[model samples]
Target: MASNIIHFEKDIEFSKKVVLNTSKKFPDPKFIFSETSWKLDQFQNLKTKLNFVKHKLNDFILEEWHEHTSKMNPSGLVVNHVRKHIHPDFLTQAWCKFYEIMCNSSLVSQKSLLTGNMCSVHLCEAPGAFISALNHFMALNHQSIKFDWLAMTLNPYHESNGHPDTVSDDRLIFSTIDKWEFGPDYTGDIFQPRYHEHLYETISKKFDNGASLVTADGSIDCSDDPGEQENIVMSLHNYEMMVALNIIQNGGSFVLKMFTIFECNTICRIYLLCCLFQSVEIQKPATSKSGNSEVYVVCKGYMGRSLATPYIQMFFKSKNHDNALLPLSQIPNNFIDELYNCSSYFCDLQIKTIEKNIITWNNKNESYKEINEIQRIICQEYVNRYKLKPIRWDQDVISSSNWSRARNNKRKINISYSEKLRRRDLCLQEEAVLLYQEIVNFSNSKTNECHEILWGRCDQVSLNISNVKYCLGKPVIQVRSSKFCNDSLLQYRIKIINKFPCIDSLSNSESRILYFKTKLNYSKNGINICDLTDTYAKNRNNNVILQYSCLFNILETLQQKSEDFLLIGYPLYTQIAVACFFVIASMFDTFAIIKPDRNFGHAFAFFGFKNLENWLNILSEVLKYILPRNDSYTRSKLALVSWLPIQQLVKQRSHLDIVLLNNLCIAYEVEPILLSFIQS
Candidate 1:
């Protein structure tokens, strides 16, 4: 046994030295000017090295090399052979290896034998190649086991600087030609513990006895330096194992893709997985290339959650620690540690030998240089075939030979400039003659109507109030009677007494009680008086009405008495109400106040005046105060009290119907009526 161990040690040392020597002859360039050139040079050197190793190896090993190289490109083989079944990519090979391990281990057969449905979870599954492979395998073999799948991957919606951080390839999903059979909501970075915690909670609720299978193909971006790249790859592998151990049920299986175990960190992770699993196997499937360092670690039959949870917790706690190895106490058994070390050592030796042999074979065969050149040429041809045409900025116009030929074939026709202008002038002359004839015909038809207006009954001196009332809707109530009806002051008054009674109507307690029944009836149909007044005031267009009113003079006088009255003394609503009153008063020939009982009164009484006599006293006082009240202004102002009030009073005594008022509020420029009511 001792001699056998020594022989194994010697073999490992020899393989390592061979690998080093093969790589050293073709040292990677410090700076590669073009990726194509670098790849071509590397390919030539690798082919030469591979050929050399073939001559040195035994017949069995050389046969395996021949089988692998005969395919030349496995991706091309996959595309051609199973082009309809699977996507031709590295992911397809990884998934094929995983499926073979599961099948060969009887995991799929056992699950099919069981009564319950099998649940599987896939981590970092974007482009969904593993899912397609699993679906294909299950469809072909284990039709008895109903499978439920959930997958987690980077969120395509996650943004960095307003652009998608990861964009999924839709072709991968569509290439399967089947509707997705898994839960699609599982998304986000798996490195985050919260994502794991969420999955744990979901599994606890939905899944019976946890998931039956967990597969992780997680990896991080690797650096060129082998040591740093190994560290990154191991860290990612450990994190994936940590999650798989936490979620996978007892008797469940886990398939992990990991690099060759060259570093202590990778070996340590494998040791931990071995401790928690009933069986562990490292496999490199035929689908995988002979030269690459990737291998799959298949762990089957988990040793129950009780045995794994504590180690899982410890892993999370010590994850931040710089040391890659777990504490001695964390190891479940001493035998696991020894077994893991032995297996890892063997794996490292095997990987080095394979890499060395590939390099030796490639270096020995000079024919590989021709193959490399051919590959570069084919690659360049493919690139050129698919490359997008660059934009051409030099050409201002697109030249079309077909269009030029068509234009050249057409017959030419031209006209003189003088002839074109003469034809246009002839058309204009014909239009002018037609227009003159139309005007003459229209004048002949309208002659009678024009004459009646020029010397009509409107010029007659016998036109009376009855004739004026017949012509206009309302009886003429002149400020000072003039010959023409148009000259008379027009007024409009909205009878809102029933709809909105004056505030002064509610002042006397006895009157309020007496009119309570009538007031209640009015309140039901009554619009808000303040809102109506405010709207009218806000929308008033004729500023001339306020400029000519006695109310403006009253406000100006009041403003002189107290400087801050506009700010503090007067409320805005009250000002709006007062402005509404003045705007209504100014537009009328005689401002009439129709009391609730159909009694005639002066308009001022509606503004809280005790009687007509009191209102007249205030009006006389206001007139005395306003200076330079000329004939026109004085007449216009007095017109507010002249005809309408007298007519109302006469109508009350005579028992006549009150005539409807005409258009009083003319649509013209007016100040905000509230501004007219702002007092001191």
Candidate 2:
């Protein structure tokens, strides 16, 4: 390619001017890059070091430059003038002031540290605030402590000079965190970012004196003694260059400012610190809104490993540190689906409760089968609440250079309704049959016929004998009531905390079910001298003679993690029919939503769990209820099968049964799904 020459002349003048200005401001606030000093253990001393008026003028100049560069950006998103008032000089002054703040004050506290002071590193998704806060603190007065901030000052003077339009718009201004070279450009801008030179020097001094921020790497693991560290604060959200978790210590308290990470992601993080910290407390800051970037803190873990090691390292394959330097690559091809299909992305997680809060079931239905169904319903409700639009599958979220050109010439896909209905009807058939088989299996086991009969099910599945479209109507479902009934301990309690039948509940049903027993004395006559079994008789509510074989807690898990109503893509009629038989093996229900999240989890964990006996049974019941599956109860085991990945729904359309269940709920006072189910 031939090169153009008009760019050189313009750039030369700007570069020269920037150098001249840098030299003039260089002496305004004399900076110390030495190893030893008095009243110098913190950045606060650096603030008092600068000349006020001279430093102010220099700060003003930098802001002016930043404002000019923003206007020159390719994507025309500039700060709103009405509220932000971001001018070039204003931005520069902001950066300098931020640096002065970083220099003079401590964003971290001694209470936040132990024998070693820990400096937690955070990235700001909105970089401006990061710098602004630093400036406000630094340009003003000293706090009790000062932190080393690596805030950036964009090189605005380079604007209009006609440089190559490569990525590198963001530049690091002042901070002692790192060298501040260009890493991945997360969102806003990640072009040619320049960093400060004296950071390494300042930080090294902190280390030699053993007063550095936190412990450095594995050799200094202290997750067990968090009360030792100072007050912890997490304010940044953009830079992924450093291991944010490593910046703090074990048992250290925290003020985390989280925005988009999912509840699961948070759980995973805490799980990693399980060993290092005795207890972990996670909370959202009051200053945050449900719609804003969310925040939460991981009470510091002090040992070699925390309680959640497995969960923390559960995700993400190793990405090389060297490769981390590339400017955020087109948001990558894989991130879009994860935003909603699996976990939270950068978007604010808005937890929506109905205008009228969700109802709490009053009736107590403690039957074994019904309680399991309630858990299924809760999970479904969550999915519906957070689910996003379907996305197309691709290696890269952004169209490749070649893909961009080809996409414009590509064709669209289409399908029909009659075909969709036929498919769903077949699914309903399979659902019915699977339910009957489980009843037969439990009856045939000879494990106390009363046990089989006492565990009542199908107590109330509202039928729609009318001209309705889908659903068995609303089943006043035993699952909804079983979880809260008084017989919970006798029925499902396992551990002290698991008594509520929830993995995280206060007490488990399994652990409490076997508390009562009658001691027997052996006579010389042996069996001939045995006494009558009347002593074993008691209130069913007072004693639960649980048959462990009959209850593997599988049903309980399904109640928690499964979805009774599955949504699928249109044209997936074949998949729907197969879903009927899968009921027994899947222990999952089928509702017909056809979306990405359902499809992927279904495809991935289809048979991945250690115990599917209960899942298979519940799934069999769901298929029997939803499909005409009851007729073929003795047939093959793949009744609930669906080769179609739920991920495919990211491309297709459908609905989940829980959402339908919710619709049935809102209409419970009016039309009741149970009325429709039984009547039909």
Query: Candidate 1, residue 378: CA error in Å?
Result: 24
Off by over 4 Å in 2: 1-107, 111-120, 124-128, 131-146, 151-242, 247-265, 274-281, 298-680
True-structure RMSD, every candidate: 35.0, 28.3
How do the residues 383-496 of candidate 2 rate in per-residue lDDT, one tens digit apiece? 232221122223111222222111121112122323333434554324333322332343234223111011111212221112111221111101211101112111111111
What TM-score against the true fold does each predicted structure earn?
A: 0.40, 0.23
Model 2 has an lDDT value of 0.24
Candidate 1 TM-score to native: 0.40
User: Considering every candidate listed, which one attains the maximal lDDT?
Assistant: 1
Each model's C-alpha lDDT? 0.39, 0.24
Per-residue error (Å), model 2, residue 394: 51
Prediction 2 TM-score vs. true: 0.23
